[model samples]
Target chain A: MRTTIMPSVRILIFFTILTGILYPVGITFVALGIFPYQANGSMVERNGRVVGSELIGQGFTGDRYFHPRPSAIAYDPVPSGGSNWGPTDARMADSVAARRDAFIRKNGVPGDVVVPKEMLFASGSGVDPHISPDAALLQMERVAAARGFDTQKSDALKELVMRCIEPPQYALFGEPRINVLSLNLALDALEKGYPPPF
Target chain B: MITVSELIQLMLYALALFLLTPPLGKLMAMVFRGERTFLTPALGWLERVAYRVSGIDPDKAMDWKGYLWSLLSFNAFGFAVVFLLQFFQSSLPFNPQQLPDVSWHLAFNTAVSFMTNTNWQSYAGEVTLSYLVQMLGLTVQNFVSAATGIAVLLALVRGIAGRSTGSIGNFWADLTRSIVYLLLPLSIILSLFLVSEGVVQTFSGSRTVTTLEGVQQTIPLGPAASQVAIKQLGTNGGGFFNMNSAYPHENPTPFSNFLQMLSILLIPSALVYMFGAMVNARRHAWVVWGVMFFLFAAGVTLSLWSEYTVNAVTGVGGGMEGKETRFGVANSILWSVATTAASNGSVNSMHDSFSPLSGTVAMMNIMLGEIIFGGVGAGLYGMMIFIILTVFIAGLMVGRTPEYLGKKIESFEVRMAAIAMLLPSAGILLFTALASVADAGLAGLNNQGPHGFSEILYAFASTAGNNGSAFAGLTANTPFYNTLLGINMLIGRFGVIVPMLAIAGSLAQKKITPLSSGTFPTDTFLFGVLLTGTMLIVGALTFIPAQVLGPVAEHFLMLNGKVF
Candidate 1:
């Protein structure tokens, strides 16, 4: 017992410093050296001001911009989480219905046109950056109209959405989706006749 | 109902795992044997330094008692450091978020959870833990606890491979080798890859950013990539942030998600092959791998079907709630099955909002004691217990003694195996019942009726099985849950480990018998089927009643358009 205790404490302390301090700190340095843009939270700058991270979603309520998925935590990056509403929970059904109604009304889509499920359901992480391409397309009419785009400009806007659509990584993983922040940023760029964000 | 693309992706993932297994497994076997490998040139010096600094004689072996004692004492000391660190977190350095000291019960729960390799987080990470606690306390435990598991397994392997020997292996040497040779190098590479894909690795505090629409959002940043790598690789699923892998910065892209999912099963799956190499039973290892793969595939298929099908009550076409759009149904369901099966409970999607039947498959994976490619070394040992039971039953049918790898499976080995098998089951069921009747448990539920019951059952099953994935809806940070779940995590971990070491000790002292026609062949295809059957029967018979009251009952209620 005595033999075990001394070695145990010594070994624990040794590992604690090695793994706890040196490993993570070492990784941080290497990552910063190689991938500074990504390692430092992938923040996007607009006109030299930090606007938001490209990977993190922020709530966009205006008709001029494409909204991200409904956030359970209202797109708060800190203290992030989902609604965690069980499928059979009435509250889930109620919220989905409410979100669906809002989506149809806000976008001025035909009542009969199916709303994308991504638009109705809150994401697991409140700050999920991407939305399905279908979900983004449904909002194009409202976004283009708010920017006062004609039919030709709407077609160009649609093309921009197509360009913004990121296929699953290597075209084999995850869903084909669009980054809402980047798309909305691109929308601003296109309207102002500036270069595309991506 | 599965699409062609989803099918192709699943197959690709499986092929990747199958291809990576042999090399990783061989590397591990060499490391544990203290043989020279490619890594020895770079890492051999570190191992020697660890031994010298700790005053450990790496060549000196210990009996099973000494090995177990050393492991427990080290873990107990770890538990103390983690617990105390949480209490003094406000005073500790690197608390950029300025989070307060954790409450005592929650601290106890977090300590027990991480120390046991369960990583069942009751408190949110970004909001609760400081960088110092996250790094020194939790991340440190992630490496050591996983190393401890692999070390115990190495001891057991030595015991099995030994001939008329009392000494198993040196615990310190095994533990150090696991970190130095296997976990550290793998983690560094994975962490760097994840950083390249946008998983955060920084010392800076949360950045308050202005949105395009002029809203302020606080983006939490940390040395997340480093921890995320090990949390997946080690099967210690505690997340750096509250949303775990679901948060975009933590997982970033679909490619990152695929790799993280792969990392969850990487070590556990390879450890099966390592077991084979060490015991000189390569064919038997493949058979074990086959059974684990079969169980895992079945769970994934069922979860996909349930998730893809329209919800009967809500009439939703796809079960998209609480899932990220980028992952969609297939990736989310695959991750769900993989995480639970491997006992790597870090989630890219919320399990609570899954369709009732989909939720059941995830719950069932843990209830099976996480041996369907379970936690790093813990999974192989847990499956070995089942293997022992299968051989014993086969021996009984043929009216001869059971022999596994030339060692006779006598009464002592059988008894220890039974204790190992039964303890986790008892911990899960008993704790669920206790929590169910208590008002404190009832108060924590996010959903009512049977679904609420599922929340309580899932919590206990997760803790007692030492698989930390939560149903998430259960408000489990309260005193009642923290204390109960903490106790159960200890029981789930050591209960199996203690008995497993006993069996290893007993096996080491026993003389090997020559193979005869009467001996049940464990490496045969027939034995794989029998082993799979025994595992299912034991798991089903033990937990089916509780499962019925929870997910099963909820399934029927869901079909009937019942909402709670």
Candidate 2:
């Protein structure tokens, strides 16, 4: 307990302080300092009011808002679930087929409609916040018609969807996915009288 | 044993990677140590804070064994901590989103996954982990886990280079400094850079924004930058977004792509030089760097050549499926090389979509033990096994006592090294064979017959090697995959590590020997080539027949434009 380099008592205290206390404290402080907003779960704001975090996806079934990938959690942060059900799992296949069928029926589209696969299968985490542009496009006409906008206006909205499409990092890794949540935010601002396209 | 078609595709990718690692590795070491940065002053602030927190005193030297032990223990503690978090997530604080309690099997998988730095992620990233859990649990572990890897490598270098010295660097100091000086600042800046490139950096929840069609849209958000930084820095592949860094906001621009690529290989590449520096032999580092370069370049060229070659049959745009048009073949090949070489399994491009041959090369990186610039600490240590083998083999050929630097190679050292090297190869084979026979396992196969067999082989290889990249097509995370992979990751890493520690302890007690006429030359160009050959031969010999049975048959089937 009395060694010169690091006493046993000191060793216990030092390690406890270092790993249990300091390591967590250090990262937390840094996270708070640098990405305060993100450190808070990327909650979106509207007119000084708080909203959800940007990291978790939400459900929007009625062509009212762009939908995210299917999730068992549906944006719950704890107990984050995955549709880890295998491709052949009748339950998984059924859920996906149901989603596919519902998606088609709601939009009055055929089975072969090019809805992105990401939108049908439950994401690894049931809480994916983005959808494919193709999936978003699936609902464009429906949403536009419901909004009493010109049928032709769907094309421009699809372009806006493309505009918000996040390219691959380094343009090399991963399938291209549009953050349905972010694009919808831009759309909301547009609906409420925001100016030219971003 | 992998078919020529598969090997050829892999060779193209490897060739490019071989050219890429040295510069990237060198630059990363430099960057983490405070060399080149777009914003220098701010990075300095980050470093200072890290210093204060880790309580690093520059003057003290750490005993080699203590350092290695601390490195492993820290990770072991992390697993415990993450497990506890999941075990008690429903009762924990700041879990505002109110996620569910984690299941035991999946939680166990998560614990081993992150602690091992494989981050295989049986559960999805966002839903399973809370803001508190993500920031404090996974993200923190990412930094420390990476630091642990770097520190161990530093200790090994000391073991090799120590003439009569009894100690290596302090584990606490290295871990602290690594996270503070290397990982922290780099991640912060890289995070900001990613944000600037349009990656989201806020904690905003689902936003109800209206689209042109008047329908409301929701935007999801959380702490991305911190995780993004470590994901690449640590070479750990679990993503904040399920799509991982491939999500547009996570990696938005071409420039960000370059940054991510740079981040993935940064610490690993630099640690090679550090190896050289610690051993007092810059030439030794160069030799390792060169072999890594040769192998990496071959992978790149093979990948691109196969990608560009179009399908040997069918000829339908080379089936270059799952590739981002924006980045092209070059980025995919480079990413594959960097990720596989370093044990970072995060993928932007799906290996599943690659030609049968291209996928084989990528898989080979894991089977070869990823010493083609391997992971931060793990890669270097794995390479040291080969280094020991090279010395011993050469010594036997010449009837001389094997020596590295001043350390005499002995029976204990060689035996331990053999264990360290043999475990991963054994892991891939034993597990793959078990999987091939298991009906539950065979049910996970997506592609049929040989190619399907390759999928199972690849899963175990990647898991057992402590390399987490997947073939991506197989349905992992069932009780079968979850349990099997969890066991593999645990045994693969510690299986080798326990042996590694034994070797270290044994070597630490040995008296240093002076170089003599009969001593094997390890620093020359010829030896470097020999070491590389030894590594590849050992890898191919172990995995080739299985590969031939798997992807090889699939390749011919594809070339003949038919499924097996």
Candidate 3:
């Protein structure tokens, strides 16, 4: 005689709801209450409108702001990606050559602007938020020309970029990289807009 | 010589983590076990209502077939969800700004990366994912998928330990309670702690901040603290910020860094205790943990010794090529040990910057098959299987039947253990040889020395160990690598996992052999010698040829200043 202990279908749904819906929702809710700002993607807001999330990279073409590494995603948020391009892939080599050429043309920068490897190569995810200050300075000339400002104004902007460059972590964890999204946003605010909150 | 401060900091981190993790991990273990405590009762009640409405089995202990079906089907569903999110993120609601469709390769990479727990993300978290995608898809999957692995491992452990038992714990129950009571509560606490340390936890859009130098910048923001909590707790090493824990928004202070470190190891370290508890021999867990801790300490000592020597004395201008000065020697060594100690791939210090001998130690840790306090669910089972094999070998010496924790070790059990051990070794060697022979792998080499050979060896070891951290010097991730390492991770993780479960199933049916005069002494010093020999002879010998070609040759080349 085999006695049966069949789990009720009701119990299965019950467990699913508990595990799937209620659990995640509950954690999210608690997170929202305690740290409302970061709970919502660590976004910063001005004038009651959403801007961008602080943790993500953004498009930066404006000269006033420091430029991020060239991205394959072109700053696309969904479907984040990397080049996944190997060193010897002909296509990867062509892309690098094209980027180097474009870099030369933009600021009439020398054939050797001493571009950072990160700047030359697309980031693994392609949406990198930081750029080397050297990469930023290379762009400083063009931004000043576009704005009809003197080199001093650009130098000031460069100083601003310098201010934003986060020091190597605890003085040794990684190389210094300037957060592009942050730098550009500050540039926008610096030109007779509301001063950014430090 | 290893500095006293560096060693002290590492141990203090370990002790603090040890003290804090157990209660939280025990709670999580119990949650996974179907004990309704804290948040579980309410969640269970809600589940009851849903089950009644949907006519589903909330209590069914899914048989192997059913379990496999549910797992695969659900995973497929996750793939679809992520794909759909990528394709439709712009059109989707809650996206403040418009972004375009995802490229095909990146989407595939993200899908597999998350599903595999490699979480080797190429995308920046704040820029790419919409709030909805992060919340509804990635975050949700992060919790559930993690719970799923823990549930599966727990079931197999029960099967192995049980005598003549046909039942493993119910998967649905295990998954349900584990998330409700374990992952959620711990995440909440961990997230709050991080938030207090100034890690962002907001929905407000990006803010422009004027620095003291009067420069303005917009800081990108998102739901970082929440993801960071689960990423570490689950041993899934996805970073919300591209720089990982080094990101200011995610790891704002030293306190946050400590907490992040603690979260990554909480479960893995505690499972030693859990295994001890489950097997009814507390000493078994302690002994395993003891051996792992000592071995882990030794690896750290060697790696740090190599690193400091290079930094303080290297005549070469590029010795510490890409290290962050802020992290310095202490943090760098600490991260090396932490990343090696567990299978978590998240790294604060770049392994590429590691000196020659230090890099070898880091690589060697993975070569040991991650039995030194390894992955979240897979780690303990890995070590336990080794113990079973050790006992069997002891039995060979005594000419008596081997028994472990009361269960008799038979020929069938030993075969399964052998299969588990052989599978990963074969996967690595065959794949390494294939890669070494292939032009695709050879083309990726940049360092014009023997160190370059080590890059290939490290790649295979990382994949086979199921540790996601990389040397980064090797430019892997092309179709050649993506495909090869993908298969390696699949085989290395599931290949060993399935065999371990099979051993469990075999042992479960065997009669308990009581201790008698004929029984071999397992806990004695004789067994220790045999076990150490097995680790060296079997484990060491398997990768020796590969190591010689990669690191040893590279070492000679670096010394001679020429390529062979």
lDDT of 3 at B340: 61
lDDT by residue (tens digit), candidate 2, A8-124: 223323433443344445544665666565454455666565445454455665565666666654544343334322211234435655777888887777777755555555554
**C-alpha positional error of residue B254 in candidate 2 after TM-score superposition, expressed in Å:** 3.1
Per-residue C-alpha lDDT of model 1 across residues B512-536, encoded as one tens digit per residue: 7777877778888999999999998
Q: What would the per-residue lDDT of candidate 2 be over residues B326-432, giving only the tens digit for each residue? A: 34455666677678877888776666556667777888888888888788788888888888898888888888788887788889888988887777778778888
Model 3 alpha-carbon drift over 4 Å, by segment: A1-198, B1-5, B21-73, B87-99, B122-133, B203-219, B311-326, B442-448, B521-533, B552-564
List, for all models, the DockQ compared with the true complex. 0.88, 0.09, 0.09
Ranking by TM-score: 1, 2, 3
lDDT of 3 by residue, A1-198 (tens): 011113323333343344334544565566677666655545555556556655456666655445666666566534344443322233444565677777778767888565554555555334445666677768767766776666666666777778877764454333465666677666666654457444
Q: Which candidate number has the best TM-score?
A: 1
Q: Model 3 in CAPRI terms: which quality?
A: incorrect
The lDDT values for all models are 0.91, 0.65, 0.62
In angstroms and one decimal each, the interface RMSD of every candidate reads: 0.9, 8.4, 8.5
* Candidate 3 lDDT, B431-499, residue by residue in tens: 878877799988866454445666677777777776767665566646777667766776776677666
Candidates 1 and 3 compared: the better one by TM-score is: 1
